[model samples]
Target: MLSRNQWLAVVLIGLLVVSQLPGPMVHSVSSRPAHLLSTLLTPLSQWMLSAGNRATRRPDLLQRREPGEDAVRQLRAAREEIRRLQRRIEEYERIRHRFGEQLEAFDYVHAAVTRWSGDPANPWLEINRGRRHGVAEGDVVVNYRDLVGRVVDVGPGTATVRLITHPQSRLEVRVQPDTADEPARHHLVMVDAVPRRGRFEAMVEVDADAPIEQGDIAFLHVGEHRAGRGWPEHAYGFDVGMVTRIEPDQERLPLLRKRIVIEPFRDLPRLSNVTVFVRREYERPDDN
Candidate 1:
């Protein structure tokens, strides 16, 4: 029932469709060997994977470097210790310089206390340095600050000291008021030690209405004792201690006198190290 030309067109279209549907889904390249391509590409992929792994592990490797890690830590610690020691040395040098400045006219001999007299009222000390080290019988013994005592006896390598707390000790001292509200005034007082209860106290008499109060400082008025035969030479402005309390003079005149109790700056019982100050010798007028 169809025309010859229409039937021929339909048959041609079916042939085109059948040609497209029958071929393989993949294309093969003919320029290279297929087996060789897989072999070469496999190694390249392995190399890329290994490179990625190494990149991720770089931070950990950097931390784990050679065995010098412990050494570096120890080196830093040692440097810090050295700096600390240097600071301590510098402090010690500063103290030494200050001591040198304080002891200008007299040379110093360092010593350690060998024993204490066990008597606060008549306190004395025995030291390990003696006449061989220029520590004479009358040399002044001092702590870092001020006078502690005077050397009484000297052996070849040992010496004895009579402290300011001794009952026989006598010193000319000046009392000063530290408060700014008070007038700038200092009063001369003769001080001596006495045993009270369990401790030794230096007592001095001042005016009943003197402005001397607690916290007032006391200094040795050295020029007053220069004319005496048995007195030790001392520089002016040597600090003795502070006035701790003011009591009524019970033995002398309680109504007319006020007793000043001074606490010495030097701690007698704790004295382990001291420096001896040697006074310069001068020929007496009688000797000349």
Candidate 2:
């Protein structure tokens, strides 16, 4: 309703009033309240943000840790499995080696021992191989170490092995010189016939002047006939019993004789298994 001139005058008055206001007063009015409000709310705002992040991040961290733990457990299991497989492989190899050795003896028909005779009066062993396995009487039995005895009887599936330590068992052995000065002497030495006190002993007669001493090694020579067919001239080496005592006899036969006592090898008492060597042919003294 006002005239145009009156409207223009009113606008000019409003502008003058705005222009007269202080610059500091204007700035304070606009910025002070906003800054104060922000300062008052800062702690609460930060707390809320932290709580939200924890709520979300906790589950994520837990999930990641779970995977790590699972990986560690799986790795341990794999290592254990590998170790078990290696042990099994080694065991198989041992069994295979033993089988191969047995097969070599099988070409000639032989059996493995199961148990030894428990009787002290007649020490013997029961073998899985018998007459059916070509085991026969007088077939000399030997272990991996030394001569065990000979097969005296055979049954359908079993055979009895007379141990070398038996009362009636006897082995003819030759004495070999261990030193350069000593000559190889051939004599028939007896075993298993000496008294129990001497059961583990060996007696040898040497020249009175022979430099024979105690603790010398006595080698047992298996006659080619006693050893199995194709068996080597000397099947085994054993420490003849230790020389415990020595007796010098000057009045004995053509040569002065010295009696040397020896202890038998420890393999005697633990004889459970032995190999039977079948002698194929006899060799003359010159052939040896």
Report the number of the highest-TM-score candidate.
1
lDDT of 2 at 285: 22
For model 2, residues 1-288, the per-residue Cα lDDT tens digits are 999999999999977986788976665464445434434544454355445434542232113223354777767655644553464344335444544453344333344555544455566665666555566656656654345566776654556677655666454554443333334433434433343532334555666666556534354543444553222333333223434566875457535678776545443434333566643323212323
Residue 209: error of model 1 in Å? Answer: 2.0
Question: Model 1: which residue pairs collide?
Answer: none
lDDT of 2 at 10: 93
Q: Tens digit of lDDT per residue, candidate 1, span 1-288? A: 879998999999977875666333211231124223333444454345445434542232113322464988767656655663464355346545645454455677888666666676667876677656667767788876556878876665667788777777777777765433344566878777675542446788888977788867676664434554255544344556678789999998998899988876545544667788864333212322
Instruction: List candidate 2 segments past 4 Å from native.
Output: 1-112, 118-121, 177-192, 195-200, 204-206, 219-257, 278-288
Cα RMSD, each candidate? 42.0, 44.4
Candidate models: Cα lDDT each: 0.63, 0.50
**Residue 238 deviation, candidate 1, in Å?**
2.2
Residue 253 alpha-carbon offset, candidate 1, angstroms: 3.0
lDDT of 1: 0.63
